[model samples]
Target: MMLKAMTVAGFSLFALVATISLDASAQQDDNLIPNDLAIEAYQGGWRSGGSDPTKECLAHFNSKYPTKRIQIISTSEESRKDWKGHVEYKYQCTAAIKLK
Candidate 1:
């Protein structure tokens, strides 16, 4: 009986540790971007154009949320057209900001 109780206690401790670790990871992810609207600047063409969506996204967010630490990843711009001569320029970027 004592051995069984010890085993149960050990399992409970392990479960508690796992739960805490998962919760921490969830909280970290939540801090990534607070508002979805702020990410709109880098949507659609912005992303396809090879422009780093992070920069445009960060800029948009910074305009409204100056307090947030916004960081943009590498950005690039490219043009691609079909054989029909339909030309379109696009911008893409990725952004990360910390929430207060």
Candidate 2:
């Protein structure tokens, strides 16, 4: 009976640890910008017409979220025909801010 109780307690501790870790990882993921929104920001920056599209996009993000650390995780370019010939730049980003 004592051995069974100890085993159950150990399992419970392990489960608790697992749950906490998963929760932490989920919280971290929540800080990341969704892919579509990141791409939208990049496109908006490009449409604004500047010397550097990437820099423009970063500036937009920084201006919008003054407190967070914004990082571009990935970027891609594709050529498209809309009003003529144009290239679209897409970005994937993560924004993290410290909690008080």
Candidates in order, TM-scores: namely 0.35, 0.33
Clash count for candidate 2 is: 0
Per-model lDDT = 0.55, 0.47
Candidate 2 residue lDDT tens string, 1-100: 1222224645742222222236777787786555444333344422422235456557767787676566664444433445855554433333333222
Global Cα lDDT for candidate 1? 0.55
lDDT of 1 by residue, 52-97 (tens): 4455566666886798776675455667787987666665565665
> Ten consecutive residues with minimal summed lDDT in candidate 2?
12-21
* Residue 59 Cα positional deviation in candidate 2, in Å, after optimal superposition: 1.5
Best by lDDT: 1
Pairs clashing within candidate 2: none
**What TM-score quantifies how close candidate 2 is to the native fold?**
0.33
